[model samples]
Target chain A: MMLFFKECRKILFSLTFLIYLVAVIGFYITQFSHDAEEKISQPMQGCEDYGTIAKEVPELLMPEAAEGLVTEYLSGYYTAYPIGFYKEVKLSEKKSAKIAEIITEITGISKRELDGFSDFDEEGITMIPDGNGGYTPVVKEATLPEINIPDTMTYERFRELMRKADKIIGGGSQYSDDNIVGNFSLVPKTYEDALAEYNDIFEKDKITGAYARLFCDYMGIIVSILPVFAAAALANADRKSRMEHLIYTRKISSVKLVLTRFSALAATLAVPVILLAFIASFSVAKLYPENNTDFLAIPKMSVGWLLPNIMFSTALGMALTEISSQLMAVFVQGALWFGSIMRDTELTGDIGRFTLVCRHNSLYDRNAFMENFNEFLFNRIFYTVLAFIIIALTIWIYSEKRKGGLNVIRKNIIGKSKA
Target chain B: MEKIEIKNVNKYYGKKHALKNITLTIDQGMFGLLGRNGAGKTTLMKTLAGLHQKKNGSITICGIPVENTTEIRSITGYLPQEFSMYPNMNVYEALDYLGTLSGMTRSERKKRIDILLKKVNLTEHQHKKVKALSGGMKRRLGIAQALLHDPKVLIVDEPTAGLDPEERIRFRNLLTDAAEERIVILSTHIVGDIEASCEDIAIMNDGKILWKGTVSELINNARGNVFTVNVPQKYLSQIRKNYIVTGMLIQGDYSTVRIVSDAVPDLQGINTDEPNCEDAYMYCLYQNGCEVQGGDE
Candidate 1:
C-alpha cells in the first residue's frame, strides 16, 4: 500500500502528469463550459437543427435521389466509408453501367439523356450590368432537362431498388440502405417536435441525465488520450531513472507491484475527471434549480460512460510500456483515439460497439441512446474486461523481466541507441 | 549464520557466454570481486543477487535454493553499478520508498531509515533531493537505501568507481562496517578498493575466475615476478613493449618503471619489489596470456 501511494506521488510530481492535467482541464473549461451554459439558456424551439435523422416516411423524389445517383455515375467516382475509412471508390465501366440501369429503372431516364443533361452557355467573359453602376462579369447557370419519377413506383419499392443500386455501387453511395433515407429526409423540426423533445428530457432524463451525456461526450475525448501519458510515464519511469534493478531485488511479488502501480495511476488520473464531473453537475444544478436535477447524474455518467475509456487507455499504456520498456504506448493509443473520433459522425446517435470514444454530444436524445443501449453496455463491459486482461499481461511481462528473460531486447535497443 | 553457496554456475547471453562454470562459497565478511571491464564480475554478482538466473548448476543462500527468489530477495540487498532513485524524492523519501518495496513495516522503515542515513553519512542531507546531491553523495544514498532493510547479504557493484580519494576511503570504511554482521560482496575493477577493505578476493577475466584467495595470497602469487627498474627516457617505450608495465613515473632523463616478468631482466638498477594488488592482478592476467596494457588503473 505504501508503494502504491509512493508511485502515485511520483506520477503526481512528474511533468507529464502536470501536462496531462492541464490538457484535461483545458479541454473541459474551453470546449464544454460554454456548451453547458448555452444548453441551460437555449429555449426549446423546434426550429433548431438536430441534423438529418432517418425518417420512416419514404419519398422517392426523382430530383433528389435519382439526380444524385446520375450525377455520381456520370462523374465515374463516388465517396464511401468502407470499413469506417473515407475512400473515393471509382467504379469500373461494368459497375457504372449497373448503376445507370438502376437509375433508369427508378426515374425512367436513359443513361445517354443523363449524360446529355449538361447544357453550358460558355460565351467567354460576358459582362452584365450591376445595379450599382459598373458592369460585372457573369457566368450563366446551366439548365438541364427535367426528369420525372414513374407514377407506378411506390416509395417503399423505390427504396428497395435503391438499396440494390447502393450494393452494386459498393456501399458508400447516398443510395445505400444506411445512408439513403438520411441523405434525402432532412426536415426542419416543428414546434411540436421541439416541445416533445423538451418534455422527453424533462420526464425521461430529468435534465441531469441529458447534461451528463454531454459531459461524458467531452470528458470521454479527454480521457481517451490524456490518461495514456500518465500511464506510459509511470511505467517507463524506473527504467529512465535506472532504478529497475533496485526495485526488482525487493521482496514484493511482481503481481502486487504491478497492480499497485496500475491502481495508483488510474486513481490519480481519475481525480481531475471526477472533479470536472462535479463542476459540470453543479453548474447545471445552479443554472436551472427548478429542473430538480439529479445530483448523481454526472458522477454516475462519469463512471458508467467514461471510466471504461480511462481504464482501457491506461492499461494498454502499461502493457505496451512493459513490453518495449519505452513510451511507445502514447503513439499507439493516440492513433486509436484518432480513429474513434473520425468514425463518430453522428455524435448524438449511433454509439458504436467497439469505439474507444463513445460520443453523445447532444443535450437531449434519449431515444437514439436507448436504441443502441445494449451495444453501448456491451462496449463498456468489453473494454473493462480488456483493460483487466491487458493489466494481467503487463504483470506477466513484468515478472518475466524480473527473471531476466525479457530485458535482452530492451538492453540491445538501448545499447544500439547509445552506440 | 548466512552463507551463499554456488556449484558450477553458468550464465549465457544468447550464444555469448557471460559467466563460465563459476563455483565459490561466500561467508559472512567483506569479499571482493576484482576484474576488468566485461570480466563477468557483474554477471556473477547479479546471479547471486537473484536478478539473473544461471543456465546451469545451482545456487543457495543460507541453505535456501536461489530458485525461491522471494525468500532470497527478502534477505538480500543489491546496489547495481548504474544505480539511482527517483530524482525528485529527497534522500529520506527515496529510502522510505525502497523500504516499502522491501516490505518493511512503517515503524521498521522509519526506524531503519534514520539509522541508515546516519550510518551512510547522509543524515545532514536527508532532506535534499536525490538529483541535488553530488555523485558521491548519491552513491552514499544508494548504499543507505540498499541497507534500509538490514538484509543478510549486501551486493554492491562498483560502489567506489567514480568517487574521489577521500570519498572512496569513506565508502570503503562504511562497507567494512556493514560487513561486520552480514555478507558483503564488493565488485570492482579498481584494485585499491579491494586492497583497502577486502580480506578475501577473487580475480576474474574473460568470463572465468583467474584467481581466488586472501588479499595477501594474491599479492604473494606475483611477489618475485614484480620488479622496479630505472631506465633512460628513450628506453621507456622499449621497456613497455618488452614487459608488462604496471606503473611508470617520469624523472627528467630517467624513468622509474614497475614491470612484471617471470625472471629478472638484464637491466641496470633492477630490484625485486613487494607486489601490491594491482601488480598482482596484472601479473595474474599476464600469466593467463591475456593482454595487460591500456588499462585505466
Candidate 2:
C-alpha cells in the first residue's frame, strides 16, 4: 500500500497538472466571475434595468417557465405567454378565483392559498388592476368577467387552454398581434417581459475579446483532457513496459494489479482535481466575498460536494484508462466534456449527465439532495457501483490482454496492476 | 541438478500448431534455443518464463510448476526480444522500479540497482533517461534490469539482434558472467552467437527441433559433406542450379563457394573445410525433411 501510494504520488504530483489547475481556476475567475451581472449591467452608466432577464422574468414566471417564454416582444423571448398565465391572467379575478378554487378542490390547498402562493416569493400573490387603474374591493371583485362560458365548461377545457399556452412557450415561436390565431388576445403583459423590457431600457453590451475567448477555449481543452491523458499514460505504464509479466510473477496477485492501478489513476486525478477545486473555490471566495459563499467550507464544498464527486470522477477515469488504450480513454473523457458542453441547458445543467465521467457533477445539489437524501443516496450508491462495474469491465479487458491475445490497444499499460 | 524441465509441451495459435510435442530439460549453465524466426522459439521461451500459457504442457523451474505463474515468475527473469523500459525513467530508476515489481523493498531495490548498474557498466549513466541512452546502453540496461532480482532462470529472446559487433560480444560476455549457477536459455536465430558461448544447442525449424545435442556431434556428422569449389562466374549459376550452395566468396574472376553435396560433381579439385554452427544449421535445413505440420499459408 505504501509503495502504491508512493507511485500515486509520483504520477499525480506533476508540474503539468499543477499548471492546468492554476490555468483553469484563473480562466474561470477572470472570465465567468460571480459579478457577471455587475459587469454586464454596469456599462449602461449605472442605470439600473428593472426586470432584467434574470431578476424579473425568471423570478416572476413559474419556475417551470422556459427562458424567453414571453415572446411577442424580445428576440430572446420564446412565446407571448405561459399557458397558465395565458388562461389565468386574462380572466377576471372572479373567474380566476373560481378556477383556483376548482384546482384547490383536487390539490387540497384552498383557493386563497393557491391565489397567494408564488414560486419565487412565498408570500406574494399576483394581482391585476381594474380598468380605472384602481384596486377593487374583494366583495365586488367576486363577480365573474362577462366572457361567454358554457355552463358545461369543465376543468379539462381550462387545462387544454393552459396546454396550448405551454406549447407556444415551449415551441419558441414569436407571438405577435398579427400572429394571434384564436380566442387568446396577446398576453396583455409586456410582450417584452419585464426582464427583456428592462434589458432594452438599461442593459449594456459587454463583448469579450478574441484573446479571452482563445484563453477560455485553450484552458477548457487542457482542463478537460490533460489529466485524463496523464491518468491514461500512467495506467498503461506497466503493460507498455512489459512490467505486467514481472509484476504478475511476484507476490502481487492479478487483483492487486487491477486495484493498485485503479487507485493510482484515481489518485492521479485526485491531486490535480482537488488542487484545481481548492484554487477555484479560493478564487471564487476572494472575488465574491460579498455573497458569503464558503469556498472550502469543509462540510459543504469538501464533504457535501467536491470530495465524493472527485472520487467518482477519478474512479471513472481510472476505469476508462484500464479498459481502453490510454489515448482512447482520454479521448472518451474529452468527448464526454464536449458532449456535456454542447448539451448545456437549463433543463440539463450538466448536459454530460448521461456520460460516466460527468454523472457526478450534480452529485449533491444542496436544494435537491437535502429534500431527497434517500433518493440522492440511491443515486450515489448506484453510481458508485457503476464505477466498480466499469472497473470490472476494465479488469476483464486487461486480463484478456494479459492472457496473450496481443490485440492492438491504442496505449499499452506498462505499469503494475492498481490492486 | 536440472533447474528447468518441460514435459511434452504442445502450443497452438488458433489452428496453427506453433510448438508440437516438444520436450526438453535445462540444467544450470548456458543453453541455446536456436531457430529461424517464427520457429516457435519465442513461444517456448515465453512459456518457460511464464509469460504465455501452454495448451498442453507442464514447465517447472526450481521445482515450481509453470502453472503456478507467480511462483515461476519470481524465480525467473525475462528480457523479451523487444527490450523496452519506461522512456521517462532514468537507468537506475527503471532498474529500481522493475526491482520493486519483482517484490523487492525500496532499500533492497536501491542496493540491487547500485550493484547491477555497475555490473552492466551503466553506473555512470544511472541518471540518464532510458530514451537518451544509445542502443548499446539501452540493451545493457535491459540486461541489468533482468538480473536485478537474481532469479534462478534467465530467459533472453533475441538479445543481440541489433547490436554493433563489439556491443554484441560485450553483451554475450555479460550473459556468460551472470550464468554462474542459473539456467540461461538464450533464444536467437544467430548461430555464431550460440556457437561462441553455448555448449549445448538445439536446432529448430518449422515448429519442431530438427536436431538437438552437443554442437560438436552435429558438426562431426556434416564434416565431409561440405566442400569448397573455385568456379568461374558462368558455372556459378549452373552450380547454384544443381547443388545446394552454402556460402560464396568472389575474388577477381573466380568464386570460392561452399556447397553441400553428397559427392564432388566434377573432379575440379575442390577443398573441404569444417562446418560451423551456420554450416550445421544450413545443412540441417537443406531439405524439407519434415512437412510443416500446419501448411505455411
Top candidate on DockQ is 1
Q: Chain A of model 1, TM-score against the native?
A: 0.75
Tell how far residue B234 is off in model 2, in angstroms. Answer: 3.1
* Model 1 misplaced stretches (Cα beyond 4 Å): A39-52, A55-192, A325-327, A411-419, B249-252, B294-297
Candidate 2 structure quality by residue, lDDT tens digits, A206-274 = 122111222222233334455565566666676776655544444445566667766765555545444
Residue pairs with clashing backbones, model 1 = none
Model 1 chain B: ten consecutive residues of lowest lDDT: B288-297
Residue-level lDDT tens digits of model 1 in A116-136: 755433424679889889899
DockQ of each: 0.73, 0.27
What are the runs in model 2 whose C-alpha is more than 4 Å off?
A9-23, A30-227, A236-251, A279-324, A334-369, A372-376, A405-419, B263-267, B287-297
Model 2 Cα lDDT, one tens digit per residue, B1-297: 447878888888779998887887788889988888889999888778766678887777888888776677677788888756767778777777667667788888888888988888899999998889998898898788778888888899899998999999999998888888688889999988898888877877767777778888778767877888887877887777677777888998998888765565563868887887677677776643633211112
